[model samples]
Target: MFQASKVAIVGLAFGAFLAPAFAAPAQEAVDRTFERIAAGVSRAGLEPVVDIDHARLAAEAGVEMPPSRVQLFSDAAVNSALLAQDLSTGLDLPFRALTYAGADAVQVSYTSADFLKRRYGLDDTEALAAFDAALAPALDGLDGVEPVPVPTEGLADGYGILTLQSAHDVPETVARLRAIVNAQSDTVWFGEVDFTAEAAALGVDLPPAVLLLFGGPAPGGVAMAKFPSIGVDAFCQKLFVHAAPEGGSVVLFNSIVALAELHYGTSAPPHAMLDERLTATFAKALE
Candidate 1:
């Protein structure tokens, strides 16, 4: 496991390097262009799951900024097979796209599926490549769009990542995760996607795999109170269960501390407690 401090440094450095790509889009053109992009994403079959209105939230907090928004979209119907290959991919899902008015030009951006597939060490390159290609239509009519670059190696070296070998198969691992969440208070079950089944229906072969999305209101409320924008990364945690290439099943999730630091630029008291709870939960489930 990567140390929290090390992960923080790496994550910060990467964030800084990518800062330019996230520059706000041009002022006059951003609104219209944003709508077009949003329409395109919908047309591509990616359903909008979360919409974070940074500008409005900042205004409510007495801070001012150009029009900006972040949206997460997902097409579980199509991408389940790809997601099943690597559960860590859930961290990037539903696919996030940001649009903002820059000093010079309005900008729209999203990380490419190819970058994510490689970053997360997911299998089936051909499938991901094709999926990436399929996303072009969404951006076809957009201007000043940027696709964030992800390094080929050390992709997740900056995040607190935990991977465990599961004694049970994929279905059982998912059931265990569900049971664990069900037993907890204030935790919201965000539903599960069985990518293996979704893929099989599409006439593709994907190893047994499932994704569990769950989290509680308390930690999320705390994080959002400190930084509303961080709500994009807060309140939700995911567990991915899939067959390991080496054999057997594996489960994975990002650490709360890492996520807090990455999103808020600082770790909070709640993070430590959340981390402990998550560690214990995973321990019990995997054991």
Candidate 2:
């Protein structure tokens, strides 16, 4: 099993620091590299779930930000194994890679394997290995370069996931959530994923589950400006609604407090109000 080095863990405790660079013109490199990654995911037999254009989102919301994009792809086997261990793991499912223009070179970032294990208590080595291997193709020819480290500690159990009981079944709950989100002003509805359907495609059985993604770039941009890599935190907020074995639907999302601690190394990171705004939007949707 892979363990997070002491250095990596400590880096998360402190603030951001320099990491090895991927030399290229910032804007062009980010878009081109992300495109290559998206193509690689398709070539690897994974379903390309969604490609989020963060820079464009920021621009539309009247917030200036550098070029940034994220590609979310699905690996059925890996998804099944991880979610089997903990349904909340769905929050990070359909694995994503974020590429953004940084100070000197374009930087690529993703959820850390070690952080995933700790946050969800994941121990499926086979699945974890498979997940790690999927990103290898994107690293070709980038010798001695490392992705930006984004290790975070959640404020509570299950990464401080906020769960709500839904009065309806999976489909209805999803529809209601969608309607609520669409009603919000300045919020961009990114996309949604039917995990149950995706797993079924691979001949696996799972209870009804769906993930809804959306963002309010005006607030999201402010949060990201303070902590660039925090986009994974909630800029593209993930709302996971899954059927509970006990017979009702449940909705899940990360708490801003937990994400703040995770990404900014503090529960009270700068621009917290923006995080609050983003969280409230989801809270209203789930309600």
TM-scores, all candidates, are: 0.61, 0.81
Cα lDDT tens digits, model 2, 1-287, are 01112221121222222122323255557767776776777667777666666655665566756666776777777787777777778888867778777776777778755666777777877777777786556444433335764565443347767777876788888888888877888676777877777778778788888888776667666666555666655677788899977776888876666666676576545455754665576566656
Name the TM-score of candidate 2.
Answer: 0.81
Instruction: Evaluate residue 104 in candidate 1 and report its C-alpha lDDT on the 0 to 100 scale.
Output: 55
lDDT of 1 by residue, 1-287 (tens): 00111111121122112212233333335556757877988888766554444444333334444555555566664376456565456546556566656445555656576556555666687757766766666667675565332223334532566677887877777788789887886565655556666667767667776766665555544544444333444444667678777766888776666655654467877777877888788779767
Q: List the residue pairs that clash in candidate 2.
A: none
Looking at model 1, the pairs that clash are 24-102, 25-102, 25-105, 25-106, 25-107, 26-105, 26-106
Top-lDDT candidate index: 2
Model 1: per-residue Cα lDDT at residue 88: 55
Listed per model in order, the count of residue pairs whose N, CA or C atoms clash below 3 Å is 7, 0
Cα error, residue 119 of model 2, in Å, equals: 1.0
List lDDT for all candidates, in order.
0.57, 0.67
Scored by Cα lDDT, where does model 1 land? 0.57
